[model samples]
Target: MGESVAGRLFSVLDAFEDGGPAALRLTDIAARTGLPAPTALRLVRELVAWGGLERGADGRYRLGLRLRMLGAAAPCPRGLLDAALPELRALAARTGGHADLAVRTAPSADGILCLVSGDRLPPHATAYGKVLLAVPPAVLPRHTRHTVGSPGVLARQLAGIRTAGLAVCAEEFRLGEVSVAAPVRGPAGTLAALGVTVPTGVPLDRVTAAVRAAAARVRPPEPPPYPSP
Candidate 1:
């Protein structure tokens, strides 16, 4: 079957993804979406009318405010913040390190639901990102010499990470930053990750232990046992 109007419209938006250039001219959109000039123009205009895209003075288009607001309202982003903030705060206080929580994200044509992509780190390079990478990305971008860009090497590391129940990064993401993280599993599997970043020279012994403990404490709030009669 032929593509739907909605599908064509979304192709225009996806042309800006992969953290690519912020703006594109009409021809860029046409080429990216593989649509003819007139068709691309029509779809672009429709999106502009609906506030889903913005056209600047240079006639370049960019994702607009409406799309960002909608992305912010996704269920996983909201739920992860509510569920992990308390544990994050406590973990930071006890360890004297930067503590964070992240969910794997899945971006579909509509918006990002949380799964299938690393949200806060390079899945092949960071502590929390490794265990959360249930589906590895096709391309691995290198950030440092320590980054495991080779697929075979990363595959080997992932095996050990699962067995150990945590992943540790020693200047893998950046030259001086070090981190360790533990996965928070749900009935379905890993739902999120809790990570702590300590100074480069600090021993991983204490922070590693702390992150594992904190990850166990992070959980989504349960629904009420009974509805009102």
Candidate 2:
């Protein structure tokens, strides 16, 4: 389908997905969106004027603080995440690994996903990334030798995740690494997932049970569609 006007606008913002706080040159935006340089420049300018994108001292583009504030207020699963934080922390503390609260990106035809991570991990091995990969053909970037490159295998893994109400990875996305995850449901319905990471040889079943127990206590947020222009 041809890009919707809203899609073009969002494409400009999406261009900054990996930029962190750094200002991106015109070429960077163009590369991220596969748009021509002239098109990227025009769209970026529009976003800046809207207070969604900003230019830095070096004359490169970044997400404005205004946009960051909006992101902070976005309503998807926020309530559940808040309720689950203490429990997630306890799980992480007891496990001495990593933890996260993840929600599937709305408007996609895919499996569950994570919204944030509690610690930095190899892009593939991180509990958050792997859960996204648990589904087939998810939008994710590879970051390690153990990353699951095959969509079919990952699809099977996702089924395991759904059936068991948990997912586990043992060197599937990295060497000498493993993790476990459980889905968190809200009073409204399922909204996000909770996960924990531990080194290989740890008992995954036990960790997954703890995450599930925590999820059972919280009410999740209603899944909302992405904002429209």
Candidate 3:
């Protein structure tokens, strides 16, 4: 059977994978999605008009910020962010660094999406990503030269995170940036990770303490009030 327009549209979007390039040329997108050049161009134009995709200054296409705004409204991350934002702000203030909340979008997905971030560092380079990666059903991706690339080495590191109830990354994602994170659990299980990023010069012990404390403060959302019939 022939593919539906909706399916083709999704294929265009899916060509841009998580942890891949931030932008792609028309040819790249067509090649990735296996669409003809004319068809890819038509769909890309439509997506751009609808704010689902963007055309960069260099004439390459990138995922639009609108998608991020929409993703933030997803029920799971939205609830976690609402519960954790206050503590996240306090953590950032205390540590003088970026604070973030991150969760796995799906059990089988390799990357954890940042629901909210107070800084500009890549997710894979931050403590928040490391904490989520430490948990089960997540596979780590090597994002930078500092990333822990070996499976055995990363396994040992994850074990330590589980034992200590916290995770730390020192310049693993970028030089001179250090991050610490702790898991935030809810009724279902491990729901998200709360993390802070600071310069490498900051005291690790203090940052670790602050991150752990902040994680502790995140409570699961209260159930919606029962509606009267």
Q: What are the per-model numbers of colliding residue pairs?
A: 2, 4, 0
Per-residue lDDT, model 1, residue 133, is 70
Q: After superposition, which runs of candidate 2 have C-alpha atoms over 4 Å from their true positions?
A: 1-11, 14-36, 42-69, 109-135, 138-142, 172-176, 187-189, 221-229
- Clash number for candidate 3: 0
lDDT tens digits by residue: candidate 2, 4-58:
8788778877655542323579887788788888888888888888887778788
Question: Mind giving the per-residue lDDT tens digits that candidate 1 earns over 9-62?
Answer: 988988876544557899999999999999999999999999888999999997
Best by lDDT: 3
Which 10-residue window in model 3 sums to the lowest lDDT? 117-126
- The superposed Cα distance between candidate 1 and the true structure at residue 121, in angstroms, equals 2.7
Q: Global lDDT of each model?
A: 0.75, 0.63, 0.77
Candidate number of the best TM-score = 3
Q: Which regions of candidate 3 deviate over 4 angstroms?
A: 17-28, 55-61, 118-124, 134-145, 222-229
lDDT pick, better of 1 and 3:
3
- lDDT, residue 145, model 3: 76
Which stretches of model 1 miss by more than 4 angstroms?
1-7, 14-32, 37-72, 107-120, 223-229
